[model samples]
Target chain A: MTDRPALSRVRVVLVQASHPGNIGAAARAMKTMGLSSLWLVQPKSFPDAEASARASGATDVLEAAQVVSTLTEALQGVTLAAALTSRRRELSLPAQWSREAAQTLASRAEHGEEVALVFGNETYGLSNEDLRVCQLPVMIPANPAYSSLNLGAAVQVMSYEISMALATPAALPVYGEPLATVDEVEALMAHIERATTATGFFNPANPKRLMPRLRRMFGRIALERDEVNILRGMLNFFERPLPGSAASTIAAPTRDDGKA
Target chain B: MTDRPALSRVRVVLVQASHPGNIGAAARAMKTMGLSSLWLVQPKSFPDAEASARASGATDVLEAAQVVSTLTEALQGVTLAAALTSRRRELSLPAQWSREAAQTLASRAEHGEEVALVFGNETYGLSNEDLRVCQLPVMIPANPAYSSLNLGAAVQVMSYEISMALATPAALPVYGEPLATVDEVEALMAHIERATTATGFFNPANPKRLMPRLRRMFGRIALERDEVNILRGMLNFFERPLPGSAASTIAAPTRDDGKA
Candidate 1:
């Protein structure tokens, strides 16, 4: 009713679904829980008669689905990709449980991030090829004896977890308000790089060696926006053209100058 | 490692919850969605043998459950209340949809308003007394032919709706700002109320009528503390005598000149 929970950034895609019916069911499941942008990666029976019928109330989602040849193409512009899987692939990293994955996505989404949670084909789940493309693997826990989860069921649980994680919490603020933006943090890092270069903290002779250490330190802080600004402001003090003295002998380029 | 989403301001109260196991499962669902506060109005078998096992890892919510005597007592100070029912109610007024009720509760919750979502005993959705107390009723659309939802399932869906309604579309401010606090907002609201009361917008004689309208308007907006302070500053434009001072002044002259 309210634009499916304002899902402007979060995208959910099911790849290579074997049963068109499952795809339809997945769409309906997603629709019910405030998710709708479904992507199909060469679905075997998608865009078919059965899928539309099974989708029941979510025919729009089925008809509007994008059919892509490869998983990479499906994941274009997706900064974080969580591949939904039933079992840990032989070659894959440790699978994140639903709660863990949802929290991860929520934390990132909290920062105004665009994320895609990818679900694989019905029978095989995520293939090794698909696993290679995903940033993290998400495994929904089910009865071990009957570990085979249907595509719609998997989607339901994952969608439920995501919705739960994104629920507006009632108590104290969880994420700091105005948490640092990606650009702000990057700008702070750039300033840190510049200041380090000026102070010979990172030897221009060996910039790589000096830079990584500084990167590690910044990583440790997980700097929020206010913290980033504080650091950048301190750097800016040095970055400022030191008061009237020691003007550059060379002609200085002005604002909007055609300098590279 | 991360904080779960905060619970909604709409507290979930189970009235005379019959089964300990069902109660435990309900607690688990609430906890999973970051809904920590649980109120049991005269629970029959809470803290029973099967509860802990059924809770399946959300013991904290169960441990913290607040048990009160009557439904009214449980709903004390609640600005709004909603009862979840599957069966048709014998209300004089027409029924409200779940979505409408959810939005109403959600908006109130946004403003830190105290609200309670009442769920009745497992056998019955809600009692006649429970229905009488609730300001709104929520009906979950299900298969009419076979619409028997388990208590936990009902809670999960209701919580899901509440959570999703609060889901946001705004981009969080990135690194470079201080987070707002509740105290600062309280101060701002106090200032505005005083000024508005003097401005006659909040009339003393017809307060109940005007106040709810004003409250609804306020409830619709997500007011950060900084914004609240700005609003207070705007309200301070009126030269309003302090209510405490005015009351004391009005009382003092009469005391000095009285028969005593």
Candidate 2:
């Protein structure tokens, strides 16, 4: 189980739900996933008997649900709001899979940021306008043939993902090995360029793409402090000859080695 | 859109539904998730006006719905059946999360196996008998405080997961980069050890785990053929003496360098 405090930071927002029963059922779904904050945008009805009956002992969630007039009004103070949809849009917001979006939401919530998972109406999903308000558009990969998830079910799926993400630790743990700071990486790159230039291994006058490739390689590695130190030490070997070094007698090469 | 033929192999079974509207809503949920085959195990009411009204244009699913008397009849030729419930059992079958269960179902259906996702009544979930009949029990991790997921919502979550598993490609794509084969990796390790031995850098007799550490490091990198070849080429520079070789004349060292 995840800490309740962290779960409390997550809000489940339903936009324009036509049925009052679905609103109640969505509250039930949210309660099951440990999400307490419920925001209802332009709901057709509230305090309806049908919603309370469908909630099935989750009336507490419905009682605490915030009824709002607009999606933007419901999203106030949220650091990240993910719009859940199965439909594809032409000019879409930045998209992520449900799992990825859940992880992002969980991580942000852990750091004390408010997060919201937004759902659309039963008949139609989020309009482009709703998606525009929410920066992150999350798509639950569904069967391409039908690809329609009910509003409450969408809530359950997102809630389940968020709960699971909070329950499980990160897939890859860095183990406290701090990554090399941007300044440290920049210094290493500059040091490499200088050393390679001095050795005639890199021609500064005709430096086409070697530096950029090396930069990309380092970025891909996501170099830790120790890795940066080791790489810099290797470059140092080429920059200056050690005491009693035999290679020092040889003149610096005037030709490139054709190596990256 | 996903190919429909694969989806047609999946069956959705709902047992003893009391409300006609939930049955209709479940059918709609299944249709949205691209599941067509629905078997109702003795529903209290079918073809009810409320159900038709709740279906909201998914009447086709209701039109084709199969009303069966027994769970065994509903499971018929299905090879894999996943029972959905939130309850914990003392002697339960193997349990999986909805996503994991969905992946399993998708893969099995891809191989032409008939798959069934079973849901129980709203008040009481699946009995032990129902679970025993099913091969895998799937649980939606909902909040511990309020874990009641409505019948329609449960169907929607499972259907959405199955559809998404089918529509999305595997999370990590190799991108046609064939990793170095075991034999190739072994050959590289052997070549590195030999070169390091010849360079008076590695003491073969008193080797203190340097070779093993290097082997593990390379394994962690998951080196491709090109990367392996490049690394071996770098080692070659240390193995054989160049025209003006001075370091090559040095005798093999007795001490270890404390470097991996």
Candidate 3:
């Protein structure tokens, strides 16, 4: 697979990061996703021992990170910028799910356009002014009840999406067999209905929505072609009596005539 | 949307945790993802000060965490267990990507089956015996060169995926206007081409690759119906002379004949 040079063109910018430990953790998260560019805008504390200690082995990213006075300075030379936020603000930039935003940024970066993903302070998040500078707002669709994603955690999620978008697409694991088509599924259902009717299990004259309920149950399973065939074959066997069986000697039960 | 009761049935298990701080961080990660159940197996330390300090306001989860002596005790009532690992092991259970595994777990949980997501020690992942007991192995696809995802980070990613899988799908933020259909976009492109040709900016007789490139650029934007109309209106204005312009006398430049 070709290396995604786009990952290098993308910058991860943190604005007014108050915790040095979070900065270190974010750096580690970026490195794990094969990203190296880091920009700090008006951080409260930098060149701190705690940041380096928390970085694990990603000190190289911290050492080479660019520190700027303002978010605008951090976004210098960036063609596109996306602001990450958890809160929904009125009149903010158009918001996209993190995955969609990652794809857009990767596409632009692949075409040699510089892209920046801006993060906000741990507690307050991005201000309206900070959000206005960004063309898009990206949100991680976390649980609504408890959506307090730590700064490093949020960065990790974003980086993970960006890496997955840029990396070669992996083929989804194929289970047992291909799923049956609509026609095949319908055929199986019809066969089962016919078997049930012949066996007096279901009366066609007074069917009380049993067939539709069965259809829904089968629909949920999404059976494969082979499974459908096996089920139909079972139904066919049930439609007939086994050789030398007592059931074959017995007459079929008549349907209830309206009399209680 | 129906609420996903499965989230409540899922438990997060950390085995042989060496650092008390990681335990706290993991609890915070779980809470952020809306998971409450936490089980610890053979942890080196419990009720430690470091753990409480790092839990960041998720002390409730830590306090409610179940500390057990063995992995079996931790998985007491789990109907489905997924072991999180970074390495591929032979003779292991079916391995799935983290997201896929989360979906499976969530589906099972929704059906009232208890589910457990197990994580191993920080230094060494799950042992072979431990993995054998689990029904599935889940791997997070990080950068191949540096796949050292911290334990808390790994927990956060898994929790995020699981929470997303179980939560009701949130509506994507709608921007200005609905996107144009393929035919509408094509018609708009044709109009622009005609206008550019008439303005002497492009020649139909010797049409170069400008039209195709322009189409690709517009395709990248995925313009809305309103955007298409605005572009065509601008093109129409460009085709004719300005209100007071002198004969629209801007001469078309000759094509570069490779003589430069």
User: In order, what DockQ does each candidate have?
Assistant: 0.02, 0.20, 0.10
Q: Rank the candidates by TM-score, best first.
A: 3, 2, 1
Ranking of candidates on lDDT, top first = 3, 2, 1
Model 2 lDDT, residue B194, Cα: 79
Residues A140-238, model 1: lDDT tens digits? 543332344445655655665675566553231133235577687777767766655554443467765444544543564454565565445445544
Q: How close is candidate 3 to the true structure, as a TM-score?
A: 0.66
lDDT of 1 by residue, B69-131 (tens): 887777766756677877664321224455556666766666556667788886776876566
Tell me the spans in candidate 1 whose CA falls farther than 4 Å from its real position.
A1-260, B1-8, B92-94, B169-260
Tens-place lDDT digits, model 2, residues B48-92: 998887776678999999999999999999999999988768888
Error of 1 at B255 (Å): 22
Question: Could you tell me the lDDT of residue A255 within candidate 2?
Answer: 22
**Interface root-mean-square deviation, candidate 1:** 21.0
**Isolated chain A: TM-score per model?**
0.61, 0.65, 0.64
Candidate of highest DockQ: 2
TM-scores for all candidates?
0.39, 0.63, 0.66
The whole-model lDDT of each prediction reads 0.61, 0.74, 0.76
Best by lDDT: 3
Candidate 1 chain A minimal-lDDT segment of 10 residues: A242-251
State which docking tier applies to candidate 3: incorrect
How much is B112 displaced in model 1, in angstroms? 1.2
